[model samples]
Target: MKLSRATGTIATLALAVGLTAACGNGGADAGPAAPVSMDEEITLTFAWWGNDDRAARYEKAIDAFEEKYPNITVQTQFQSWDDYWTARSTEAAGSALPDVVQMDAGYVRQYGATGQLAELDGQVGVNLDTDGVDETALASGQIEGRTYAVPVSLNTQSIIYNATLLEELGMEPPADGYTWDDLVQWFADVAEAGAEHDPQVYPVGDMTGNNPWFLQWLVQQGKAPFTDDGQIAFTEEDVQAWADLWAPLRESQAFFPAKRAAQLEPKTGLNSAEVVAEANWDTLMPNYTAELGSDDLELMPIPTGDDGKKMYWHSGVMLSASASSAHPDAAAAFIDFMTNDPQVGEIFGTSKGVPATDAQKDAMTIEEGSPDARLLAYEDARADDVTEPAPVPVEGYGEIEVEMARLSEEMQYGNLDEDQFASQWFAYVQDTVKAE
Candidate 1:
C-alpha cells in the first residue's frame, strides 16, 4: 500500500525463455521434494496490489512466515491496482516477474496462455490443498488445461445498500428472494423518498454502463455474455431489453445523471452512503463500511429471474507463481502458506475477501456483528442458490468491456437510444469475437 511509481524497460521475450530454464525446477515434470531443509537459505520476491491497511497486515503475515521458516526470506512489493498491473506487464515482458505474483481473473487467461505463469498443479514445491476449498472456486484460476493460479479468496456479487438510509426512510430492507421487479420498485421508492431530503440524491449510482452488472443481468435471464467458445452469446434484442430496463430510471432520475455519475468514485456516492443502494461485489462490504464511517452496511442477494439465482462464487483474486521465477520452490511454499495457513487467514480476515478453504474460514474469528460476519452469513444462506459460473473470459474480452461502457454512456446521455445502443454493441461484439 506504500505505492510508488516504477518505470523500467520491458525485458526481451528471449530473456523470458532463458529465465524459465534457470528458475523452473518446480515445473510439472519435476518430482516433489522433501520438506525444505532448515539450513537452506532462499529468498523470494512477493508482489501484490492493495492499500496501506492490507500492506500492514501482509507485513505482519510475512513476519510470521519468516519466523516459522527462518531460512526463507520474502521481499514485498506493492502498488495501486492500476500501477501494479503496469509494472507486472513490464516485468513479465522482460522475464523479471516477481517470484509470486497477484493475479486477477480478467488477466489470468491472457497471462496463462502466454506462458507467463507457472503451472500450479503437481508442481514440486506447491501444495494448493484443494481438499477443503470449493472446487468451482479453485477451478476459477485454471486456464486451458493447466492450473496457473490458486484463489486467494472467494467473492460473489450482491446488492449492497446503506442500511441506515433505508431505515431512516421507514423502509424495510429487501429480502433474499427479491425479484428484478422488486428491485426496480425499491429504487423508485427510494428515489421518491430521497427527493424530500435532497433533490439531487438518487436511489443508486451510475452503473448503467458497467459490464459486470450487465453480465449478471444477462445471466439472470438465462443468457451468457460470451459463449464457451468465446463468442458473443446474447442477442441484440437481449441488449435492448437490458437498456430499456434502465431507460425509465434514467429519465426519472432514479440514478445519477451521466455527467455526475462519471465523476463519482467507488468511495463516493453509493459506496459512501450518498445513494441508498448499489450492485457491487460482496468483498467490498468492509470498504463501504469504513468509507461510510458506520456499520450500517448490508448485502442482499442480487435480483433473480424465473429460473432462480444465477449467482456463483468466484475468485476475488489469485496468487500465481511466475514461470520465470528464480526460486519457484520458495514461491510455491509462500503461496501454500498464504492459502492454507489458519494464522495467515486470521491476519488477512476478509481483507482479500473470505478465505477459500473451509478450515481457514472456520479459523477466522470475525466479530459477531461485524461486516465480515454478515458477508459470511449471506454467503452461507444462499449457498444452495449458486449456479455454475460463466466461463473465464477469453483474451480480447477487455475491448468488449470498453465498447460496452462507451455505448452505455452514449445511451445514457441521449446520443443513442436503446435500439441503437444494442445494435452497435451487438455489431461490435460480433466483429471482435469473430475476428478472434
Candidate 2:
C-alpha cells in the first residue's frame, strides 16, 4: 500500500520536481465573526505533491468545497513527488504561496525553528480537534514547544506482499511468529523462486536504507537506534549485526540494483513494482489505485524479530505555515479542516498515509477500511517498538541519500561482504554525523 521511501531520500529529492504554483490567500479572517472566507469572494491556492490519483481526489474535493463556499474560488496545483517542496519553499521565501499547503514532519520543525513557517493557531486552525492523534507524530512537527502544523495521518511502514507471488513460490507470507532465521529462510525461498519469477522486493529507500533497517535489526535484538537523549544508541556489535543482516541480504540477491531503482520516477516507484514485497506508506493504497489495483495487493506488518520486536516509521508530514503569510488565520483554518475533518482524509486517501484523527480514521469506507484496519493493527503490534527520525540536526541533511545510495548500490551488487558493508556504514555514521 506504500512505497519504501527511506525517510532520508524521500525528504531530499522529493522536492525537486516543480509543481508548486504562484500562491494566493483565501478570504478567511481570524479578526472577528467574519471568517475571511465568508466575507470575501476570492481565489485561494493550495499546493501538494502526488500522482494523478491524488490530484483527482483532491481536485474533486476542492470543487465540492467551492460549491458550498461560492464566494471562495480555489486554485489547486499538485506535483510529482520531486517538485512539490521546492516550489512551496521557494514561494514561501519569495512571499507568493498558496493559502493552504502540504507540510512535512521534519521540514515543519526546521522551518518553524527558523521563522520561515507560520503558526496555524489563529482563525484557520482554531477549530481543530486534536483528540486521539498520535503524540509522536504531533511532536515531530512541534518545535521549541509550540505546535506548527497538524498531521494529516499516521502512516506506518510495512512489508506489502504479492499474494500471487508467494502462492506460486509454495510459500506463505511471514507472520508475527517469524524471526530473523524465518526471514532468511524466506529469502532462500525467494532466491529459489527468483529462478523463475521476481524475487523479494525492496523499496530501494534512499539514505534511509543507510541506517534504520540495521537499526531495526538491532531493535529486534533489544538495542536502540539512537540514545535516549539523541546520541549513538549501539556499539560495533550492533554494526556487526547490521552487516550480518543486510550485506548477506544483498549477497543473496535479495533486493534490486540502484540503477534500476534510481531511474524510477518519484511518486512512481511503486508503478513498476513486480517483486513480492516492499515497504511503503499505508496512505498511498487508496490514492494510488491505478498502481495497486483492487484485490491484487495485500498489506502485512513487517515481520517481528526473533526477540519479538517490531519497529515502524511514522511517515506522516508535520505541517506548518509560513510566518510571513498575511492570512495566517485562514491557513490555520484549512489545517484543522484537513486533519480533523473526515472528508479531507477521505479526499487525500492514502496520499500521506492514514488519517491521524480517530474520527476520520474510524469513518473509513469499506474499501479503505481493510487496509486501515491492517495499519491500525500494525501500529498496535509495534506500539512499544522503537522508531527514529531519519533526519536530525546533521550537516548533510540532504546528502544522507547519497551516502545511502552508494551503500545500497554496493550491497545490491554484492561488491562487499556483509561485515565490510556494516563497517563502512558505521564509519560513514561517524564521519557523516560529525560533519553534520
Candidate 3:
C-alpha cells in the first residue's frame, strides 16, 4: 500500500532564504555517496510537483516498486509549481528536504552547485543503471562533471493544434519545413476560417515573452544564448526583434484576447479551447486531451528558422535525491526503478513525455491510434531535427523567466510596447543574473 502524509507550511524563517539561497555546510554535505543496499527496512520521503493525474500515476508505479522490495516504503507529497519551489527552498535552508525531488533544468544549477543534491555517479553501476540512455539527455542532469540527477523523459518544442477543429474547418496543419513567416501567414488563415464557428477560435497565443522560444530563436540565428560563466549572451536588439515578430498579430488582435485568457487561470488557450494552436512541449498532448474532453489534439514540429532546423531535445523533468537523506541506498534504488523500469513506461506512457531510455521506450506498449502512439511517433520523426545540446540554465534562471512572463502579460494588456518591454526586461536581467 502507498504511504502519504498531509502537506504543511514550512517555517517562516526558512522562507526568508528564498529560492536562490544555498545551504551553508549544513548536514546535507555533498560528498561520499552511500553504497546501494536494501538489506534492512527503510522509509523514504519522495516529493514532486503536479496535478491529481500525475499523483495517481506515481502511486501506481510506487505500488509496483514496493511489491518487489517490500522492505522500502516511500512516503510521498506534492505541490504546484510555485509552491513546490517555495517549500524546497525552505527545506534546503533547514537541510530537511525530501529524499527525492522532481527537478527542473532551470534550477539544477542552483541546487546542485549549492550542495543540496547528491551526486549519483558513484551509485551508477552499483544501484542506478545508465544503460541505453541518451548521452545528451543524461548529461542535462549534470553540471560540469558530477551527476546530480537523471532525466525521466525528453521533449522538444511543438506546435500543438486542435485536430478536430482543423478538420471541421477543412484546414491543414503546418507543413514540414514551414518557416517563421509561413507560420504567421497560417495564423491569419486560421483566424479567418475559424471566425464563423459558434465559440470562435483564434490562430494562437502570443508567446513573445516565452524565454525558451527566445533562446531557440537566438540559436536559429547562429547565436549563443548564454556565456560559459552563465551570463546573458543576447542583446537588447535581439529581444526587440523577437517582440517585433509578433507585432502584426498583436495589432490585428489575432491572438486570443488577453482579458479572456486571464479568466482561465491555471489553464492555457489550448486547454480551454480558446485558440486553435499553441507553441508548447510535445508531452502536453494527454493533458490537453483530458482538459478538452477530446482525443483530437496533435503535435507538429516547430517552425523552421532562417538558419534551418536547430531545435534541441529538452530534459523535460528529472529525478534527484537529497544529499541529506539517511537512506541514500533506498533512495537511489527507487530512482533506478523509476528511470529504467519498463513497467513504469507502461504506467506513465507519455504523460511525463517520451521515456528517456531505450529500455523504457521499448517496454511501453503503444496502443494503435492513441495519444501514446502518436507521441512516440512524433519524437521518432524528429530525430534528425534535434541538432544542439539542451541548454543548462544558470542560477536564478527561474526568477528571470518568471519576470519575463509577467512583463509579457503587461505587454499583452497594453501597459508596455515592444520597445519598453525589451528595455525593462534587460534592466531586470542586470540585477537578477549576478556572480555568486
- Candidate 3 has an lDDT of 0.79
Candidate 3 wrong stretches, greater than 4 Å: 1-35, 168-170, 195-199, 305-307
Q: What's the TM for model 2?
A: 0.71
Candidate 2: regions farther than 4 A off: 1-45, 63-74, 92-99, 120-125, 193-240, 254-274, 283-294, 305-313, 368-398, 414-436
Order by lDDT, highest first: 3, 1, 2
Query: Candidates sorted by TM-score, descending order?
Result: 3, 1, 2
Best by lDDT: 3
How accurate locally is residue 310 in candidate 3, as Cα lDDT from 0 to 100? Answer: 84
TM-score, one value per model: 0.87, 0.71, 0.88
Error of 2 at 57 (Å): 2.7
Per-residue lDDT of candidate 2, residues 261-317 (tens digit): 667755343445545555565555544434666444566655565555455446375
How well is each residue in 1-436 modelled by candidate 3, as lDDT tens digits? 4334333345532332222124333123534455555576666677788999999989999989988888777767788989899889878777667778899877888888888888888778877887766776776788886788888888988888988888877799877888888888888888888887777888787878778888877878878787645677888898899899888888888888888888887788887887888888888887788888888899988877565688888888799988777666667888899999998988887778888887888888777988877888888998888787677777888778889889989999999999999999988887787644
What is every candidate's alpha-carbon RMSD to the true fold? Answer: 4.2, 7.9, 4.2
Could you give me the TM-score of model 3 versus the true structure?
Answer: 0.88
Once model 3 is optimally superposed onto the true structure by TM-score, how far is the C-alpha of residue 176 displaced, in angstroms? 0.7
- Candidate 2: residue 301 lDDT (0-100): 58
